[model samples]
Target: MYENLDDAELLRAALDAMNREHNADAVSLLKILVDRNPVHPYGHYLLAAEHMQLGMVDRAEEGFARAVALAPDFPIARFQLGQLYLVKGDGALAKSTLAPLADLPSGTALASYAKGLIAMVDDDVSGAVEALQTGLACEQEILPLAGDMQRLLANLMAPTEDGAFPAGVETTMSAAPLYLSAYGKTDP
Candidate 1:
């Protein structure tokens, strides 16, 4: 049904579907968008997000990776890919993937998120909590991502059975799923 729409229109329709919580329709539209415009990074990114929402980790990784490969400077895509790796228990790859985000302005949400993930991988619970809190404080552009980070932070800071916090950062990645906002004319 969406085949008749041009790329821009298709993206808008997909965004509308997502806003309305019609994930299946949004996924269908995004798949068509990516198939028709294979080189558009946002299309791949959006499809990857749908895959993530559906618990299809492998597909999400592939889509996010494609998006990052097509647009190296796309910080959100890069951060998501890296976080995916971190969640999958691949710390080395996650660190490598998130490394470039360090070059972003230091106080930006993406930068803080990357730092938080890196600290988590290193088992530094306190550091991760601090960075994630900092990220939540300043996050503006991508509210969905900020919400995801907030959930992650809450999980990380949750206390253990004995009323003491966990000594190290355990992989609570599954406690919060990645939430992606729809892209507009500008790339997120």
Candidate 2:
């Protein structure tokens, strides 16, 4: 029962709370926004993200579905929905959801990242390695994901004789490869 705030104001407050990691407050603001504009796709998107942060996957799924239903062309929400599907072990659904995004300029990196994760989850080691490598090449800002992706790739590309990791794979010289590439190496 919010009194006078408009959708933009509520959205602003939600973003502020989300930035502060105040997920509960973000959810409250998003709820008010949704109440005010149930058909607004972004409201549902914010709610879904907050719910995901809170580990309420079922509710998050519902909100994400609502967002997609309201605006099927919304790339970011669809990408996040695909990620949720991946987390739920629904590889087929995740791939299907993420596939269309690959064609959009804004969605290219996200689609690649999701596909890479899907490949990893399916134990398609070589495929994951390739996808992750391409993802990194396409979007270096995905460096945060690069560490785990590199670890996974290293394990996949490891020699199968004794199942030991291949050389230069076990240890990383940088957690932020993009930053390292930009600034010329990191401390560790």
- Top candidate when judged by lDDT against the true structure: 1
Model 2 spans > 4 angstroms off: 105-107, 140-188
Our tally of clashes for model 2 stands at 0
Report the lDDT tens digits of candidate 1 across residue range 1-188.
66679998989888788778788998999999998999989889888888887889999899999999999998888988898888788999999999899668977988998998888788787888899988888846777677777777887788777644364434447534445433222334
Candidate 1 vs. truth: CA RMSD? 3.2
Per-model CA lDDT versus the true structure: 0.80, 0.64
- Each model's TM-score, in the order given? 0.85, 0.71
Clashing pairs in 1: none
